[model samples]
Target: MADFIPVNEPLLDGNEKKYLNECIDTGWISSEGPFVKKFEAEFAQTVGRKHAITVCNGSVALDAAVVALNIQAGDEVILPTFTIISCGAAIVRAGGIPIVVDCDPVTWNMDVNQIEAKITPKTKAIMVVHIYGLPVDMKPVLEIAKKHGLKIIEDAAEMHGQTYRGQPCGGFGDISTFSFYPNKHVTTGEGGMIVTDDDSLAEKCRSLRNLCFQPQRRFIHEELGWNFRFTNLQAAVGLAQLERLPEFVQRKRKMGAIYTELLSDIPQLELPLVKTDYADNIYWVYGMVLKDEVPFDAAEAMERLRKKSIGTRPFFWGMHEQPVFHKMGLLKDVSCPVSERLSRRGFYIPSGLALTEEQMQQVAMAVKELFN
Candidate 1:
């Protein structure tokens, strides 16, 4: 079998093992310890957030964000239809209705134009996902949210170190969430964090992250919360990864540019479109849309890539069509045309940190030949 290139891979050459050793030697291997604090501080600084609250995973970070924002039952939180389900799920978990809509065809993110139409009286927040490391067009989203009394929760899970209009991806929303999953730009084995500028929200987030401990006394509980804490071991690894985040982002951007250059003339595939102003895409997943007139289906193309040992996969089907959402009776007359079309036809291929120049070239060549 040929060597299989992956979509994403953790680069562990830096201080991962060294920090792991330090964590092990210190015996603060559980959720508590200094490493977590250090990681949170560094991460907040990276994103220009006033505070950072570490958590177990990206999902938990979102959940915490909603709760900190005081989202109540029946309240609506707007989201994109084409994205990882976790973005919407966090709202439901926090007792809010997830009002999802279509994203832009160009950016494959929230359609800022469509947002105003969906705003109802009950709308409380908006969860804008920075899909595939491309920040959502936030200038209008923020303006609309401000006109109404809606808060923005940025899902920056796939976009570490990505910038938009000179601001970091996570810095746009009132509160943003990040993932340190192994395959992310930065890895922590498994971890997440919430970034925010609101001191009250941050304080609420800090308390909520650790099971609502009373400041007056450690044992005394105030309100119910989760033990969604990031372990010292994980934080140690994250710190190491953070130190090299800039390099990772640069390499990803370079790889994306190379892919575009090589595949520019390929009529079978449609490359991603990043609007000039917010196009500082970190290229987390390297998504590619299939040409409307492609002879073969995107799924078939994915199979071809896999057969060549160059792994690829199709994009998310719109959430309303998902089995889970269907079960919730969300398969009604809602039409998010862009998301609906892209979901079935768009796909991404391997673009991990470990991909060498030769590997990237080979994959691009294979794609061209497969289509020809």
Candidate 2:
């Protein structure tokens, strides 16, 4: 039997062990340690932000960002239909409605052309999620935001080292967020960050992550805040990962090139987009959308690959199609055909930093065998 190629595995052969061991030896394993501050500072500098607030996870980072911006009821946040439910949930939890929009069929990102059509008096923000590895056409998104006086929330979770028009991905938004899950370019086991240049927003996120208590007196609270604090242990791992980010990004791009080279000619598959005028695809995970002429959708295709000991993951099911939201009578009339089709047909192969050339060959061979 062939060894199973898992979809993701982190490359932790760097200073991870050294930093973790240091944390253990010093007994500074919690949130109150130097590594947390160091990680925050270093990451802020990397992303070209004045402040980067560490959080327990990416979901909380979005939640905190929405709250920090004071997005209230009657405000609408325009976001892609093809995104994790966390994006919509954050807006909803902040008492704002999420206005779903279709993605560009080719890029699989929120369509900038559709953005203006969705705008209304109630629209307050546009949430641009850099899907897979490609940055959204931010030049136009920024233009639209400016024209309508709308805030831009950039979810750079999947785009750690990616840039838009030479500027880092996280630098474009009023507030941006990142995840350090093992699958991400940067891994802390589990951690997240929110970055912004706005000083007041930065302090509010800091206070919100720790539970809105006045710093002078720990027990006293003026506002409700969740315990979304990041531990020093996680930060230590993140710092080690951050130190080697450029190398990781190069590895990701190389993996993308290998996959595209091997599988580009397969007739039944549509590979991840490669380049745009703004930026090149970083290929965070090598996703492919099965062409309609193919006999199987992503679920069926994934099962076939699994039988051959190849692991894969399906694309995000759009928020508008989510049962929870549908049951709540939200987005009842929303129909994003492109997003729905992508959700059903698209999935990613093994594109982890730890993935080897041989493993990618096996994966490409497996996919070709199935398609052929």
Candidate 3:
């Protein structure tokens, strides 16, 4: 490889520094400011949500959504095992049991087909994570939730601008969360947002993000809340990002095409799957499966790719099998064989914004060479 290609890099242009400097000059760099509200509005418009309330990070976005739903302790919130630990963390913080399930090997998203079987009297909600920019099939999940009156919390931490049934990913759920971390589809340095169609829920989110204050009076601490606020400086960066949303989505899809065209015939790899109607799969991080024919385990594969200057990441460690939850006796009868199996066998090389078609070709060729 001529140069090391990173998985993802934020495309910062068009007055990013100017906007941040403006925030500093105004001396309103703290959480509450015009830029914060402006970014929230633009984000809401871009994602097709009625409201968007900015917060600290993606985990906090989910945390505020779950807290607003008022899930009682011991209530269960179903999620996928093939995700970052933040989803489980939010559920635990909200006093709910994190009911994790395996993902479909093809989509690598929550096994929506298995969800109904897991619903019970204690089930309160379902958090759908659109992993790798492939939006989860939401129609069936929504139907299941409606029949049982369960809230749907969308973790669009990875899937921004992705659509399902002509609707944006986040808008499908009762409450949706977005992560604007540096590496996400968009960025605000480090920030998160919760969006919702319900005005009451939106109000609740605003209150929750601002330490549960009454808002009418600055010092009237209405309820116990945390400091989950986004600074104006971060918001300034996000505003610039939001303006390029269309171009960003377009570029992502184009890069995805490069990966698909090159890897289509590689039996050792399985590309990301999609539903027929979505018409969108913004490549937040393009993922692929290394079939059993490959000699090395996922860790070894990552090590090999690293030596070649091709960065790769292993699949998420299955949450049910993690020591953190095992200590709580959460996995006594959990037998998600697929999740556990894939966690060890699968590794993925991301197709990020910085990679050119030529770089992707080199990546694919390197992997093929390794398998031989």
Best by lDDT: 2
Of 2 and 3, which scores higher on TM-score?
Answer: 2
User: What tens digits encode model 1's per-residue C-alpha lDDT throughout 56-112?
Assistant: 999899999998888998898888888887877787777788788798888888787
Candidate 2: tens digits of C-alpha lDDT, residues 103-200: 99999999889999999999999999999999999998999999999999999999999999899999998999999988999989888999999999
User: Which scores better on lDDT, 1 or 3?
Assistant: 1
What TM-score, computed on C-alpha atoms, does each candidate reach? 0.96, 0.99, 0.95
Q: Write the per-residue lDDT of candidate 3 for residues 10-110, one digit (tens) a residue.
A: 78876689899899899989987799989999899888888999998989888889999998799999998888888888888777898887898777788
* Runs of candidate 1 exceeding 4 Å displacement: 217-220
- Model 2: per-residue Cα lDDT at residue 290: 89
> What lDDT does candidate 1 reach at residue 4?
85
Worst 10 residues of 1 by lDDT: 325-334
- Candidate 1 TM-score, true structure as reference: 0.96
Error of 2 at 187 (Å): 0.9
TM-score-based ranking, best first?
A: 2, 1, 3
RMSD of each: 1.6, 0.8, 1.8
- Give Cα-based local distance difference scores for all models: 0.85, 0.93, 0.83
Q: Which clashing pairs does model 2 show?
A: none
Off by more than 4 A, model 3: 216-222
